[model samples]
Target chain A: MTAPVDDPATDERLLSAFLSGDTQAFEVLVLRYRSPLYNLLLRSVRDPQTASDLLQEVFLRVIKRADKFHGSAKFSTWIFTIARNLTIDHARRMQHRRHRSLDVPLGAKEGDAPSANGTLVDRVVGTDVVGERAVDSQEIQRRVAAAVELLPTEQREVFLMRQLQGLAFQDIADVVGVPVNTVKSRMRYALERLQAALADFEDHLEGTR
Target chain B: MSTCEQHQDNLLEFILDELPSAERRALSDHLSECEVCPAVAQRLRRGLALAATLPIEEPPASDTKAIMRAARERSGDASTSVTASTSMLPFAMTGRWGRVRAFLVRPQVVMATVMLLAVAFGAWYVPRRAELGQPPAATMTQPLVVASSGVSAPEEAPAGPDGGEDSAAGGAAQPAPAPPDTAARLERGLQAYGRSDYVAAIDELNAVVSAPDADEVAWTSAMHHLARSYQQNGDCASATRRYEQLFRRSPSYNRSNQAMLEAGTCYRTLGNEARARELLEVAAQDPATREAAQTELQLLGEPPRARRPARQPASRSGAPTAPTPSQRPRHSDAPY
Candidate 1:
């Protein structure tokens, strides 16, 4: 019988079982973390295909490196660290590819104001999610997602780990390799930024509430 | 810390239900009395409520199945089910052509056949050439071209220091035609790099760089990626070597200065400060690389060659000038 999926202790045991040749344990672990990790990757890269590929890669790495899990850290922390590193690498590669494109001037700075073409969030938030006919809840979700995307990468990641994955501040610090205070500071900044960006949505938020 | 400051630190913990009860109560009491704190807490709570609206998505069931299959395969239980073997028997026994097709589809069989043909051709062709008193064919020096990803290919003809010396040393011999999949291999390497599988990236990029007939453009790009893969894998020594080779081989490459800066940084990590300084000095001469190179130099305790006006005012405490890793110039100018 499978253990409870939500327990951190169960996660560690699943990993141990996987390392000891029980492939089903690994599957249980994958199912447990799939939604959270996929959500993190999707909001991060803003592409469903890339997120799916990254999700598979994360599990593949866990499978390959199962022996490296020493149990000192929570399994979630280790898995998320791997996921975070891959996303960072994906961002770097995308940035590099953009810079390499012939049409983009070499001197164009990183973090330049989004082109008049708009940000990925603007491009991806379809009429279904943000249209006038959409419900207040959907509109609020669309606005919140767009705002989260607009935050700087550091803040956005911290916010997602806390708000989406419900990672403890200390666990987030371990994953991000920063101090607990630093994680909290980033989380605070992220919330403040989200608040400011969605200020105009106060009426919508209140209506939904 | 001020009462407000102390309470502010606990604000997130309080909302997230992570704070100890005593501290949570203390912050709650303070928030009721503190005008600014309540608003801030309200805003944070509002942000959290709004963010909670973003729906949790289920990944495709196919991806979950694939992950499980991969895990099972890697754990060596991939063959536990005999269905695949039984299913292939009908196709294998269909006809002579079916058997041949099945044989050809086995990678090991195809590879062995290719090797046998090459060996037979070489034995017959080389002796014929010697009998006619003609020079040996240039193919003698060419590395065996493996059609696969080359991850497990023998490294008999290792890439030279600059990744081009072997080809250059071939002198008057006509360059071999690059295998048709050079671009494909390079792309795979880059994809692996993007996935943070640096070891796989190194393998694929190394194969691209070592190809006897890789064009100048592909070879240079492969060398740069190979170096980065090594660097990302924490093999600083190999990374530095590849970076220096890239810098020396193609000084005119658009990103040579960036490579030099990276090589210098790697050297610093490897404790060869003198070499690091040498390369960094050269990198600092390029406008594109100057700031990062100078920052690395500063970290190495070397004074700046010239202080361009600070982009922002120097901090009052004169904190270390090196940019955080995120702020550092990363492939922003790479030619890719």
Candidate 2:
């Protein structure tokens, strides 16, 4: 991903300069980090509108608490930590609301609200309607989403942050508040289960050949 | 740990393309040596490749910019209000003055003032008569002879030997001063300045600054050091003024660039933003002047102004120069 292009040193320097009374240095810092931070949050939270809202909240917190970024870790790590914590808090709130509402179970909800999951990908891909093509691409994506959802929560988080979000394993450990080995183990178990679940399709392809 | 478990775990991250380079190499080596690990590694890699290809969609590009702009605007507002809150600080300090004035305006301060006046009057007026043994409303005190009645006493004296005599009559003794050798004094002043005795240097330099026939070198150098002395003494205001004088009078002095930077910093420290920016911008555009200017302007949130190459003053030659203003370098902006 071209390493996301926001130089950690430069970001920290801008932050330090801002704290030292150069307010405008912060503008460049904000402009530079916004996109990567937005992408990270969107992928984690999985809701575009909510992710957009939380992205603003993250930057607002960044500016207000700029002095607290003491360069103890790489600036990227610190920023992602902020994003991670905010994402978790947001998810917890969402979970509480969802539980209180006591809505339908997963597969039924998926069937009824095809537009919710399927349309998001279709709209993003800008193709014909998601329902028009239930072929390999859509089926594969649906299976991948289901497989990821099926993982234990901690394993899912570790997998998302590590593989999809491109955070280092150490950072995943920090984000999830576990030992690095524990994160690795969860990822191992998660990957094994996914591989097993997709074995039928692999075997069916072998048979067709 | 069991070999099967370890191999399986390594296969997971290796398949996902998430293993670090060193670990990936190690896993590759392990797969080549361990027969059973290959099947596991292959299956995991294939499965992960399939998962990766499942095409997780990104948010639309239009949304990216829109969201970021909204984020920036929100944060900007938050920071602006924080800045506004800081601006209220001076007013809070001034609030104490109002409270102090209110207390003073109460009847208590006036009553104390009256009481003080009464005690002072009794001590002075009532004691004077007894101390002098003068009584009753005594006859005519002849008009006190005021010196040189028609002329004004010239408020003290003009600050010289004659002034000292007038001062002596008012109850202090006077000392004679030696004649000053302007040339010798200036020479010694430069020497003292070179040795860093700025106190003696300023004393010597002051004589040269005021001398009627002072050479430009001596006058400029003296002013520069006088400014430096004031700066070293923590009198930044005086130092800044002297530096301004040095630059204005001798703009091509060896230290003029340094002086300009220092003067800009002093103006900034004193909260004169416009003047500080003006000087810093000029300094920042010159190749010779950029470093110091860089530090100052980085803290000011302002960019340096474009600088024209040095031109001979038209006043000196009475002819317009060939290089037009538009030919000058454009302002180079540094990142905030």
Candidate 3:
């Protein structure tokens, strides 16, 4: 959680505890990172099962080699670097982009802005979770998912890592093995692209009220 | 650093709430005065807020439970069966090839690749000259490598003076290369050590160990290989002394545990059982170097492994203080 960011003892501390033979700290560490790690693999492999399996492999690999982690690096960077290498390995083997059938908007057009009276965005933002609203939420998700899918792989990684994972720019540089400047540039590009894609949705939200 | 154009990008970062407070303050001030930036910032914030409304994709409860259970088991045992709990890494390029690709873009690796080529040539050509009954090119001209600047150790060192050195040789030099720099000399020493030239290695490493010009990094590599050189050259006296100096000066050196281990081995070689046991006990504290120290301890007719907390010493009279069975010096376990 982002709450841990303000805690004096962060991921590195948990890692240190795990390394020093505290098995419980290892549990906390895994729980804390499981979702982000899983989501990263999901986005990369575009398969929940493969992503879940890969997440297991990532933590296992990190644990087996945890004794070798140099404390100088943020544990987040080290773990993400491992995650990235594993994802890259999958990418190399497949030799193609992961398919995202979710990118195609349903019950709506890709470029069409949401309507005030009734639209996918209206149903999602509205306080309803019934039969129709659930479908609406799913559609909104597909649209948002496509927005990320449209991004270049590097830009998407920067976005997922920054916005979702809340990683610092410096740590993202370590994960991607790029200069911090490059990471910042990539994030800027991702934010701009996401902003453009989602602008209509924001306008719809404001217009409805 | 924010120009009007750059501030536009800064506006996006600010809206994401990712900018540092000082930059955030500067941007806030900029937005208040600038005609276009405030509007741009507001739009960006709203757009970002819309994106944030994307629902979180929570992992399956079963998968989370399975993962947490595996983590619990795996953390307890280093050799636990990975198959039951872990999946194989998805990528095939998980080894040296991947690291090589990563290194390709780094300036340090480019310099190192060039140096490795030179070292490879030297390793091939220098010996061929000797075999061909001609003076070695190394003897005629300097084959010095430059000292790389960085803390390269990938694992924790004991709480002591930092004396860590990575096995990879690096540092940029002129096309011809200077032989006098500490890094170059240290590299030359390691090359000699590699070729079984213990005498040459000892001399070169000694120069780095004693020189005022030598930095801590140079001192580490030289001191480590120097002791090995002495031990290999059948001089345990000097090897033990050098190892002792390294132990004292750099308690936190990457090879500090190895220092204790080697010094113990050297003392064992010199028939000094008391000194050997003393150092071996210290080496045994670090899990990294524990097995080797225990092996040597057993070789000296002591218990197989007398594990102890680093702060707690072994029983004063309980330890079997017999001399080593043989006079042979142990080989250093340092990766470099």
The 0-to-1 C-alpha lDDT of every candidate, in the order given, reads 0.63, 0.52, 0.59
CAPRI level of candidate 2? incorrect
> For this target, which candidate reaches the highest lDDT against the unseen true structure?
1
Please state the Cα-based DockQ of model 2 relative to the true two-chain complex: 0.04
Candidate 1 C-alpha lDDT tens digits along A117-169: 43334422332432356455665666577666656566677788877678888
Tens digit of per-residue lDDT, candidate 3, span B1-336: 236656765665687677889999988888788876666566556645655655557676766566555566666665663532432333323368657655674779889989999999989987788787757555444333433121232122111112133533333233322225666666667666544456777888888777787767668767877886786555779988898888888777766776787778778756677898898898889886676677667656633222210111111111211111011112221111
Tens digits of per-residue lDDT for model 2 on B64-166? 3433343344345655544333222112223677577556656889799899999998888777878867763531221111111101112221111011122
In order, what DockQ does each candidate have?
A: 0.24, 0.04, 0.09
TM-score of chain A, every prediction, order shown: 0.80, 0.63, 0.75
Give the clashing pairs for model 3.
A89-B91, A90-B91, B160-B251, B160-B252, B161-B251, B161-B252, B163-B253
Pairs in clash, predicted candidate 2: none
Q: TM-score winner between 2 and 3, please give it.
A: 3
Error (Å) of candidate 3 at residue B64 is 3.2
Q: Can you list the residue pairs that collide in candidate 1?
A: none
What TM-score do all the candidates reach, one by one?
A: 0.52, 0.41, 0.46
Task: Report how far off residue B217 is in candidate 1 (Å).
Answer: 29
How many collisions per candidate?
0, 0, 7
Which has the better lDDT: candidate 1, or candidate 3? 1
Q: In terms of TM-score, which candidate is strongest? A: 1
Residue A87 of model 1 has an lDDT of 80
